[model samples]
Target: MSLTGGSVSVRHPAQHRGRSRLSPQAYLATTGRILRQLLADHRSVAMILVVPSLIITLMYFMFQNAPHRPGAPSPFNNACLIMLGVFPLIVMFLITSITMQRERVSGTLERILTTPLRRLDLLAAYGTAFSIAAAAQATLACVVSYWFLGLYTEGSPVLVFLIAIINAVLGVGLGLLCSAFARTEFQAVQFMPVVIAPQLLLCGIIVPRDLLPDWLQWISNVLPASYALEALQEVGAYPEPTFVAVRDIAVVVGFAVLALCLAAATLRRRTP
Candidate 1:
């Protein structure tokens, strides 16, 4: 972006190897770099991640002495599953916004734009990084919850791992779409409420759809979490819940693909 250095020559396709296709290895490498960046960024790691863990802890204490039914199931497992959908939204948004916005302002994104590397690959890298970060955080949270709050699950850890990974990946793809559309870092931050807050309120988290009005229930049904929550709960609380949870996993994969297309469309646009 600096004109004082005279003309800048962008590298051609043959000049670079990793940018041409969406390589999972390349994506994982970029994700490692991004994690190093996060470790260096201690403040962000605390606010977006540590704070949520603290919030969960506080909620547990506040509800500790409450009444319990004779035959009621522990809702914590499913609640954690519900939290997976919304919590990753924040983490993914933070990850994508920080990295992409920095690149955009520093001209790194501009340089990459002229290359053979597809925008989808670029976005996929961010999502990959976020997915890894989310997994680590979820593991930490699960450990803390089990040790301190007596959290237990009747479901398989393998299933939980799958759900967490898919949820994180899908969330990161969504965050990329949000970051791509944002004109500025502040705008990206602003987009969070519009993008994620709705899902938190309506995705069978706070208020169930059946309790809401007919139109509102219909609206909530369209949310990604509507399907995801069912899958998560089925794996946790209601092991025999209707519909195949594996199919919901498929839906999460579909969302990731769809979000990749949105990212591609975003980078493809011209100033006109």
Candidate 2:
């Protein structure tokens, strides 16, 4: 097009030309960072990957073959798999404050903020890394729980994958929310025993809500992880179809957005 001064104005293609979108690349890079960090901390890596498996295996041997078998054919196996739903989130919670907050303390956060990259992008990358870390542990546990221990999933493996992803994302969201306000990594780690262990006890993972006291049933219903664990057990082992599935998906999504917003607000507070 010709302008008023007899100058030509050219329009660039809206299609991004040769440039590719960044989500996949960013996610890959983020995954790489997570692996590197995990590798750097050998003991921590052992705790995340090995401990969960050991505990899971111990559960399989002890619970699956117990004298008082569950109502379902694969009661013990189902319970072990249910346990996997809780670990990813707990591990992510323990690590988020350690890694992301440490960046803030070390001035790296300020440097990143000065770049063209978005605050949300940084949040996402870290969150993705944590989610993947949790997912890895969960998947490894599922393999043993299902194939070796005779855990049954009436639903498809694909469905289990979806549920696990949802659980990981929800965990990352909660972890990020905690990270945003936690003053130090020690405090973050300290908070976990209080924050996560109760969920395990109250959430449908360890025990069925119907069997719990009336007051406690309401408590578990309000917890996003509780719904997720129920959904996973349904799609993975037990295969129950109910409103809890849809409700869990909604709760997980809501918590994710809340966590992201909290992280952003915290970052903004730290900004000039």
Candidate 3:
């Protein structure tokens, strides 16, 4: 009986090893599970999708009523561009961190680790799922701003849409990285100041990077948000894709990939 049991265990592991590569079905299952979880949680849905839209809408109305000098750039376009870069960062960062922390706290992550799931598979699923949500959020925000609030851009709307999606995906990557360090939802939220606020301050939204103190300008050079906002502005200002716009977009996407890789490396099977 002992020999038989030992042989069965060895064969089981060998069979598992033979199938160790990431399975598409498993990846899809994980993605679907996350999407369904988001759907089931009305508050999560509201926070992730609705709240950003509401804020953007309010900003639109406020700027819409403001007076503009003849031939001056419209405040609507300015506000839309800022919101395009910032809102997704805020929403996706909060949602991804909190949701992942919840899974860690609930032992779901640990249980998943005991199964055949690969870390890459899990992270890729998350990245894909969140990117989809980010795309939707970007589309809705852009449509509302352009169609209803009368925001205008000289650049192609397709470029604007693509940049917005990339920015949102960057948020997801940063959120995942931050979540790995946080033990609770509150700690995850606290990361906003550390991971996000600095980027916002130095990303040339308020003061142009060149106008900042030399050291601060140096700091802005390394931050992903700086590139993202720059890409957004470039696209808005240019009618077609420019070399600078493409370079900035590439940088932002690179940062997203790096952060996600780091997140996968830091992910723990058990809560510490």
Q: Which structure among the candidates has the greatest TM-score?
A: 3
lDDT of 2 by residue, 1-272 (tens): 86787988665553342233446665566567766887798886776678877888787777745665456555565665576667666766776767766776667777766544466677788777766676677677677766776666777665565666666676666666666666677766776777777888888655678999999998887777777777776665435554766667677778767777777666642412
Q: How close is candidate 3 to the true structure, as a TM-score?
A: 0.93
Each prediction's TM-score versus the true structure: 0.81, 0.77, 0.93
Model 2 weakest 10-residue run by lDDT: 13-22
> What tens digits encode model 3's per-residue C-alpha lDDT throughout 1-272?
25754643345774785478877888889999988888898997887677877888898878777888988777877877888888888888888988889999999998887778877678888889888888888888878877877778889887888888888888888998899999898999999999999999999988999999999999999999999889888888888888999999999999999989999999987568
Q: What is the C-alpha lDDT of each candidate?
A: 0.68, 0.68, 0.86
**Candidate 3 minimal-lDDT segment of 10 residues:** 1-10
**Model 3 whole-model lDDT (C-alpha atoms):** 0.86
Q: Output the better candidate (1/2) by TM-score.
A: 1
Taking the tens digit of each residue's C-alpha lDDT, what string does model 1 give over 1-272?
34785977777546675446656666666667777887788886775568667766876776676666766755554455566555665676666765677767767777766655567776766666677677777776666666677766666655666676676677777777777777677877887789777877787777776798898888887777666776777777544533667788787778877876887688633221
Record all residue pairs in model 2 with backbone atoms less than 3 Å apart, i.e. clashing.
none
Q: In candidate 1, which residue ranges exceed 4 Å CA deviation?
A: 1-29, 74-79, 239-242, 268-272
* Candidate 2 lDDT for residue 216: 94
